[model samples]
Target chain A: MYHDNYEEDDLAAEVELVTSAQYPQDADVDDGFDSEGVVSSQKQPIAVEIPDTIKNFITYFHRNVLENNIYELHTLYEVTFNKLTDRFYAKQPWPEAELISPLVDDDQVFLTLYRELYYRHIYARLSPSIQDRFHSYENYCDLFNYILNSDFPVNLELPNQWLWDIIDEFIYQFQSFCNCRNRIKNRSEEEIALLRDNPQIWSCYSVLNVLYSLIQKSRINEQLLVNKNGGDMLEAAGEYGSRPLYKMLGYFSIIGLLRVHCLLGDYTLALKMMDNIELNKKALFSRVIPCHVTTYYYVGFSYLMMRRYADAIRAFSTVLTFIQRTKQYHTRSYQFDQIAKKCDQMYALLAMCIALCPTRLDENIHNHLREKYGDQLAKMQKGEDSISVYEDLFQYACPKFISPNGPNFDDPASLSQVNEPYQHHAKIFLSDIHNQTMIPTLRSFLKLYTTMSIDKLAAFLEMDADELRTQLLMFKQRSRQQKWITGNLLEGDIVSTSDLDFCIKQDMIHIAESKVGRRYGDWFLRNITRFQDVIATLEHKN
Target chain B: MAQLAMNRPEVIQSLIDGVDRYNPDNISILEEYLATQCQNEEYDLMANLAALKLYQFNPHLTNDRVIINILAKALTAVPAPDFNLCLYLLTEPMIIDESIKQLTALHQLLEQSRYAKFWETYKSDSAYEQLVSEVRGFSRAIRSIVARVVSMTHQQIASSLLESYLDLSGDDFAAFVKEQNWELKGAIVQIPVNKDNEAKTVVIRENIKFEQLTKVIGYSNEM
Candidate 1:
C-alpha cells in the first residue's frame, strides 16, 4: 500500500529524529549531495529541526530580502546569530558529541553560509584587514562558540522550515561567492617569468581540480519538467523524474564559475570542466533545443582565448552548422519571417566569430578555418576589418531571413494578411537588436583588434569603429521596454564582432527555454524573418 | 583429403542452414555488426574495391574514376550518420498521423529533399506523376456520389493515404464531414462553424486557384 497522506509536519518530525540519532555516514545521500563530498539517499530520513524563534527570524529575513528592506535583514541576522550562540551552551547535551556530523556537508555548507552572512553583517564596522583576518569558517565558528559560552541574551525557537530555506539560499549564493573569490585571489598572483612556459600545463595542475568539482553532477534530462508533489530538485537530484532544467541550471552555474576561474588564468581547470561539458553534451543537446549555438560559441571562445585556434574554429563551425541545419516552420507572414532572420543573423554572427579569428593564431589554425568554414572563411579573408565581414553578413542575410508573425500552416490569403503587419513589426524589432545588440558587440571586438599582430587588418576594422560605437551608443540609450530585457540589455547583440555575441544571446535564450518549457520558435521565426526585411530595406537606402 | 571430400556438401548445407535460421533479432544484431564493420577503414576500402570490380561493366553502379574524384573531394569530411539520422527522423512519413499532418509532412519532405543533390532524383517531374497515379489509384475506389462531394489536388493525391480515404467512404461520410469541418481551404486556413446545419453544402472547385496552391504547396510561407 502506497501512502498518499504523507504530511509535512510528520516529515519535519522525522527529520528531527534522524538528526538527533547521529547521522550515518551515508545520511547525505538523501540530500543528493555528491560534489561537496556528501551523499544521501531518499531512503534515509533527514530530521532537520529549527526552534520557533529561529524560524520566525529567518522568515522575517527572507521577507525583508524579497522586499529589499535592508533594516529587517539586519535585525533578523542579529537575532539569529544571538540565538545560534545560545544554542551552543556549555551544558548542551549534544555539545560533547560533535555538533556537526561528518556526513552532513549540505547542512554544514548551509550553516557556513549563514554564519558567513551573519559575521559579514556584524563585522561591517571593523576595518577591511580585521574582516579578512576573521573571515575563515573555523574562525567564524569559534566566534559563535565564544558568544554561546558567554552570557548571550537569546530567546528564539527555530522553525522546522527555516533551515531548509536557508540551505537553499546558501547553495545559490555560495556559488557566486566562490566564483568572485577565485578571480580576486588569482589576480594578485605575479606573471610567469617566461612566455615559452606552457600556461595550459600550469593551469591544469591549478584549475582543473576545482572545475571538476563544480559540474560533477549528473546529466540533465527531460524528466525535470515534472513537478511531482513539490519535492525540491536538489533534494531529489538522483530521482528519475527530476526536471532537466534544474539540473541544467546547476550545470550552467558550474560552467559559469569555471569560466570565471579561467579568466583568472586557471585555464587548465576550465579546460577540464569544458571536457565534462563536451562529454555530457549529447544528453544536453538532445533535451535542449534551438540555442545551443551559444554553447558551441563559448567552447570555441575558450579555445581561442588559449591560442588553441584550431579547436576554437571547430567549435564555432559546429555552432554555425547546427544553426543552418535547423529548419524554420513555414509561415506566410513576413513578420514571422523576421524572427527567423534574426535567428540566422545570430548564427551568422557566431560564424563571424571564427571568421575573424585573430591572425596571431598559428598557420595550422588559419588553414583550418579556411578549409572548414569555406565561404564564411573567404569572406573573413576578403576584408581585414573584423566588423566589416559581420556587417556584410548581417546586411546581406537579414533581408532573406527575418519575419514577424508565426507561420500559417495553411491558407494563401490568410497567411499573407497575417504576415504583412508582423513583417513590418519584426523588421523594426530586428533592426533594433542590430542597432542595439550587435553594434556594441562589434565595438568590443574592435578593441581586441589591437591585441592582434596584424596591423593592417586591425586598422581596417578601426576605420568603421566609431560608426559601430555610435550605433551601439544610440541603442544603449534606448529604455528597456520588454519584460525579458533586463536592465535594457539586448540579448543577441551583446557580443562583439570578433566575439560570438549572437551565440551568447542564443545560449541565454536556450537557457530560458530549457528553464521554462514555453516554445519560442514561432516568435523566433517571425522575428528573424523581419530582421531580413529590415536589412533589405537598409540595403536599398544605401 | 578423402574424408574432407565426403563431408564438404554437409558442411556447406550447415552453413546455409545457419544463415537461414537468423530471425529479425538476429538480423538486427547482424546489421549492427555490419555497420561497425563498414566503418572500419579496411572494410570501407574493400567495399570500394568490390564495387570497383562490379563497375567494370555497369559504370552506373560504381565508376572507379568518378568514385576516386568524389572521394578525393570528400576526403576532408566524413559523412555524419548522426546528422543523416536526424534528417531522417525529421522527414520520415512513418510518423504521420492525421490527413493534414500527412499532407504537411509530404510537402515538407518533398520541398527540402529537392534542394539536396542526394535527394534531387526523388523530386523529378516523374516522381510527381507517380504520386498522382497513386492518388488516382486510391480515388478509383470512391463511389460517384462521394467523388462528386470531394475535390482533390495533385499534391493531395500523392500524399493522402488509401486508409484515410476509405475512412471517409460509405456511412462513415459523416465522420469525414466532421473532420473536414475543422479544415479551412481558400483565403485562410481556419475552421468555419455554422450552428444547426448538419449537411452544410461545401463548394468543391475542380481547379484550385494558383495563389492557393503556391500558398499551400510551392514556396514555404516562412521562406
Candidate 2:
C-alpha cells in the first residue's frame, strides 16, 4: 500500500518547478539546498504563526498522548489534518498546485513527521504478514521526499521545544526501524550499501543524531549490530568537525557506544572507549545523568575477557558497591532484587579474577568465600587432583553469573547460549589453577626453611629436580613481570671449585617471596578504596 | 416441584454471586454443576470464575496447578473468555501448558525479577486492559512476590521506594504494611520473617540443595 506517486518523473517535474521563474532565486539563496531540495530565498520573510487549533492539539499531545499512546496520536493526526485541510479549502478555493503555499506551518509538518515515525516504529514491531499491508516506512519516506521536493524552508525551527525533541526521537526511530527491517529481511550487502552510502537516504547528521539519542535514552542493547550501517556516517561526522556535536551527545553516549562494542564482542574497542570515558570522568559523571551500573559491569566484563584481572576486579567491585549502595533504599523492590542478584554474579566473578591474578583473598573475603562455598574452597586449598570442585562451581555459577536475570533462565538451550563465554572463562580459570598447584606447595615448603637441597626439595614435592627447577623458573618469570615477588631463586655454587655445584642453597632457593600475601593486601586496599569512592560519589550526589 | 435446570450462565452467575457473598458451599454446588456442563459455550468463564473463587477463598490454593489447568482450558475455549482471569491463573508458578506460551513469557518475566519490563509490557499492550480490569489482585500478587524476594535479604526498606515499586501511594503503602502486620518505622517498612515462613524457607533451601547435589552427582557419573 505505498503510494506510487513518488516516481522519477515526479522528481524531475519538481526539480523543473523549483528552477522555473515562478520562484525567483535571490542573492541570499544558497546552493547548499541542492542536496536537500531546491531552495528559493523569500522576498519577504513571512511571520506565520501556528494556529490555535494546531497549538492546542500539540499541548494535548505533549500532556496526555505521546510515546505511550501511539494509536491515539495516529488518530489525532488524521482528524486534525483533515480538519485543517477542510477549513483551508472552505476558506479559499484550492489554488493551482504550483501557486499553493504550504497548507500547514512548520509546526504542523513536524507533528505529521512525528506521527509518521511513530507509525513506522509500530509497523516495525508488527509481524511480516501484517507489515506487508502496512506502508508506514514508505509513507515516511514519501513525506521526507515531499518535504525535500516542496519549497518548505528547511532552516526554520519548529515553534515548540517539545517539537524539536519529537524530531530527534523521530529521526532515531526512523533509522532504528530501517536497521531492524534490514536485519529481519536479511537485505543483500548491495541493498544495505545503497541505503548507507547514499547521502540523500542517510546523512551523517541523521546517523549521529540517532546514535546520540540512543545513548541519551540508555538503550545500548538496541545499538548492537545496528551501528554497522552508521560506521561511515560516524567517520564523516568526525571529518566534518562535529566535535561539539559529539560532546553534546556526552560521555554517557561514549559509555553506551562502549557497551555496544562489548555486546558486539569487540572488547578492545570497548576498553579504548572506557579509557576515553576515564580520561573525561569529571565532565562525564558530573552531569545530572549518572553513569549506569550496567556500563561498569560491561566494562568489567570486557576487561575480564581481555584477561586484565586487576582492572576487571576493580570494575566488578565498583558495580557491586554501586548495587549495594542503591539496594539499601529499595531493598524490597524487584529492581533491587535483580540488582542484588547481579551483584552476586559480580562478586563471584571478582572472586574468580582474584583466583587468577597474582593475589590472595584477604581474611574477610576468604572467610566469606569459605562460608559461601565451603566445600569448594576447602578442595581448592587442599590442592585436590580432581576437577570436580572447579567444574561444580562453574556449573553452579556460570549460567547465573553470565546473565543473572535473563528471561530464559529456566530454558536450558538459551541458558547454554548465554553462558558459553562464562563457561569458557571458567575453564581457563580452572586450567590456570591446575598449573599453579606447585606454587602453593613451594610456599609451604619454604615456610620450613630459608634453604634446602635441590634433591630433598624435589623429594618433598614428589617430583624430579629438573621438573622442580622448571616450576621455579616459571615462578621467577612471573615474579619478574609482577613486582609482588621480593626476590628470585638464583642458582649458585656451594663450593669454590671448577666442578659446578647444583644445590638449593639459601640464595639458590631464595626465601620464597610472600607475593601472594602482598598481592592480597594490595587488592584488598584497592577494593576498599573503590568501595569508598562509590559510596562517596553516591553520598555527594545526594 | 420441578428440579432447577442449572444452565452454564446461571452456574457462572451463581458462582460469582456466591464468591461475592463468601458462600463457599453455594460456589461448591455451582462448581460441581459446572463440571457436568463443561461442554456448554459459557463453561470457560464459569470454570475460570470457579477456580478464581476457590483461590480467593484460600490464598494458599494459588500453588495448585489444577486451578491453572482449568484456567488454561478456559483460555482455549471458543467464545471470548475472561482473559484477565486466565492471565492471573497463568501467573501461578509451575504452569506448564504450551498453548499459553505468551502468558508464560509474562510469567517468566516476573519470575526472573524483571518487574519494570513486566509492567512496561503489561501497560504498553492495550489488549491486556481487560485482564487488568478483571484480575484485580494480580498486581497485588506481583507486588507480594517482589516483596517476598526482597524480604529474603533486607529486614527493613524505605517505604517511598516500596510505594513506587508496588505502584502504591504513601498512605496506601502505610496502610498495606499495617494490614500485613509488618512494623512500620517512619518511612521504613520492617518486614519481619514469620516463624512459619522461616520454616518454609528452610524447606526451599533443602530442596535447592538436594537438586544441586543430584546435578553434581549426575555430572560425576557422566565424567
* Candidate 1 lDDT over residue span A217-304, tens digit each: 3223212322323445555455311333234444553444444433332233344344334323453532323224334544554443
Please tell me which predicted candidate would have the highest TM-score against the true structure.
2
For model 2, residues A1-542, the per-residue Cα lDDT tens digits are 11223223222233221214453333342222112112222232232333444334444444233243444554454344335435642222122222222322224444445445344322222222112112343444454444334443233222221222233334434333332322313344443344344423333233334444433332222232123234443433432113322233333455544554443334544554443233223433323212345566666665555445555666666555545456555464323544555566656656555544535344554555556656655455455653566566545443211111112323435423322334434543454445555554564575576446667888888998656654553333222211111111111111111011122221144332322123444455456556666876898999
Ten residues in sequence with the least summed lDDT for candidate 1 chain A: A505-514
What C-alpha lDDT values do all the predictions have? 0.31, 0.41
Alpha carbon lDDT of residue A332, candidate 2? Answer: 44
Clashing pairs in 2: B84-B131
iRMSD per model?
28.7, 28.3
Residue A467 shift from truth in candidate 1, angstroms: 34
Candidate with the greatest lDDT versus the true structure: 2
TM-score for candidate 2 (chain B): 0.42
- State every prediction's TM-score relative to the real structure: 0.23, 0.34
| lDDT (tens digit, per residue) of candidate 1 on B85-159 | 111111112113243232333333321211122123323445433332322222222222122112211111111
lDDT for residue A151 in candidate 2, whole number 0-100: 43
